[model samples]
Target: MKKIMVVLMVCLMVLNGCTKDNTQDYTKVSNQTYLLGTLVKVTVYGKDVSKEVFNGAFDIIKNIEATVSKNEDNSEVSQINKGQEISLSESTYKIIEKGLYYSQVSKGKFDITIAPLVNLWGIGTKNAKVPSHEEIQEAIKKINYKHITLDQKTNKIQIHQPIELDLGAIAKGYVADEVSAYLMEHNMGHAIINLGGNILTVGEKPDGSSWKIGIQNPFDARGTKLGVVTIGQKSVVTSGIYERYLEEGDKQYHHILDPFTGYPVENELASVSIISNLSIDGDGLSTVVFSMGLEEGFDFIEGLDEVDAIFVTKDKEVYLTSGADEIFMLTHEDFKKKQMKK
Candidate 1:
């Protein structure tokens, strides 16, 4: 009787272990709080994974915030702002270099050096207020990416003007890419990293399904869905006038600003979302497309290959590039009609 009881106990323990393993096989959700302003949620899907993958991914994002955030006293961006030439990590240097290139490519439409203007407007902060014309002009004078110089020999960065560097636009996407890479390295079969609205998918769901992302409708405040895009192993980023804004006395001001004018960009579109292989590219393109009005934005999308875009105009018109039309599903009746007509 004792021998029989031992066998049964061993069998029960084995079955319990198998069940636990199966539960972990489908999805493992982990979240880390860092980045100074946002929460990073990482969902890994695989079997027999350790906590190390999550820790490593979280560390990458934390390191990025340490390196890039102007709010951090020890950050490289802070050093540059204080007129100190400081050496940067390779990842930090790459992101800034890409930011500078995009700033030039977009003709200053998307700029990291517009931090002064951002602070003056204070749309996303507690002190949100409208700045005077003179204040805006002074802010604009300090807002030029060209003044930021990079030393190739020492990999050091310097800012000629008294300007702050804000990576609010692209840092999340870059961190998403880094986290995705970390997951891939750890043989994480499938994963989704949603840094606020900046989403990156690696492989597919555990059941071999594509990742579905919902684009928020700019007109709706209660998270109404504008459309849905299904993608695998790609990054989806959206830049909108709705995400962060301030309203006062029948006037509304958004966070995205025109670097030259130091005011909110006056564009026909309410929001622009980009889907691309590289999360950083998607981040940069979303801002660029939003700054470009409808006509120029459509032209830019048509010129690109492998990059898809969806634009929601202020008039509630939805525009999809040839590539985007394949994966996006319209949820609203008006947009459904428009999609049928196309």
Candidate 2:
């Protein structure tokens, strides 16, 4: 199995605040488990919080994993990849639907059907390798989003081609969103759902303030912060070349592959962070924008509504969208914030 190392791009800072005596008795309950290829942690602070809440949240993740995980032998995606028609679960159907939307948004640059290329490289497994030019070309030919056939009425999916579907890019965020919804439904408002660094804040801090999130320093070790972003009830997700890669001799290949060339994307960006109301959007857009490089990605983000981005270049310069400055604060001297030229 290929496991994604904890890409701690956005780390949770000290979540402390002073609450007014009249409304400040919220208790904190948190638990961590290994699920969906990474460490999943769910923390909730609210009156009457219980272990059952965490259990239910994690259970939802497990259920979703079984339905959408491409690595699982009998998952819906796996079945579809094998060209076996199957009735999909609601979660699987919606994730595939949204994945197709992102595919279109990136003009097929961030394709979920790039599973053929993903397996060809195997960057995160013991079989990790650099495939031959011919192999890469073959894999690229199989990566087309149009092969996926989703029957909304029957909740079934069919793929006539030999393409495989990998949901790694967006599944984590969708799981986080579902968990967040579950928390809110159970009256747990203030919570932090971190699925291996895909951070989703449920509500304001117990003290009625925004949560402080540290943006990871791409060139530094895990937990190192280049800056901090303060927000309330939003999803913050980051994608970078440092997240996963395979090193061979003096050369290293990152996990973000380009469907066109069937190789790791070559760009000036070290990382891209997307902040949005939905974790699913953040998850997909981070990868989509990262592949677009700094300039194009910045322009794309500016055109989108209710979305903000933080782009950190390999040269240690940071660029932010218009709305980003309101929530983000640069704290590292090594990383200087630069204004994107209009």
Candidate 3:
């Protein structure tokens, strides 16, 4: 799972900083809770709003988590992982369907069937360790997205192999989008949905300006910002090696595992942030681009429409896609923004 620890706080600080003059009469309703194995903060700015709106939004998140989370023993995913061919909710079915699409898009680099490799290393859990080469190779053999069988008509799923499925990379984004839509349906025009590192803005800020989102400095403390992105009604999601890892002596292993090698992906990138109309796209693309490394990832993102990316190298340099230059601003002098080759 991509757990963004400090970026959420930085975004809250940015939103709170806007009301210094007290001239904004827009009502701000905010609440925080622990969900999806991370902190989820939802805030809406509108006139005559009540906190009760959050209850519906949070319920949507809870329902998705219950349906898709592999950690939940009774989740539909878990049941399917256990060799049971089962019916899925329309939402869960769509999430898995999209996960498979990303798997194909990244050429299996960003696979939901990577749970076997993830469990073997257990980077974020106490069981984390460097598995034997033979063990890793065995796990790799089971990490094929092609083994998944989905029936579109009945919303049923079956696994043809002994593979575990983990939707940690993309589930939260789906939840964020669902909540955003729910809030909008209730007539809230402006809001910030921060599901750990996945950020989706409902509209602009209450004052008719873009919502300023702090991009986490992968090498620094969590709340420390390397830059801020000004966006309206878009989602910002980042995947990085610094957040979750396992260390052995002088060697450190990050949570992002390469399915082919059954090891952490080695690259020039420390993190990749994607901005898009839907949080799920940002979520999946962030991981996909990170795995592609800097140059190829930059070119790939540049070729895509409605998607822009920020590639931060381990050396502390920043590279932005064509459209990113308009909204992303460097806030730290320590990080140098580089110009991408045309």
Q: Evaluate all candidate structures by whole-model CA lDDT and list the values in order.
A: 0.74, 0.85, 0.83
Candidate number that wins on lDDT, 1 or 3: 3
Q: Per-residue alpha-carbon lDDT of model 2 for 176-239, expressed as tens digits?
A: 9999999889988888999988999998897788888889888988788889998999999988
For every candidate, C-alpha RMSD to the true structure in Å = 11.6, 2.2, 2.3
| TM-score per candidate | 0.88, 0.94, 0.94
Determine which window of 10 residues in candidate 2 has minimal summed lDDT: 1-10
The C-alpha stretches of model 3 lying farther than 4 A from their native spots are: 4-24
Any idea how many clashes model 1 has? 0
> lDDT by residue for model 1 over 163-265, one digit each (tens)?
6787767777788888888888888868777776677888876666677777777776535776788887888888777777777789887777898777888
Question: What TM-score number comes out for model 1?
Answer: 0.88
lDDT of 2 at 1: 11
Give the alpha carbon lDDT tens digit for every residue of 46-99 in model 3. Answer: 777776888888899999999998889999989978888899998899889888
Whole-model alpha-carbon lDDT for candidate 3 = 0.83
Cand. 2 TM to true fold: 0.94
Model 1 bad stretches (over 4 Å): 1-25, 32-36, 158-160, 336-342
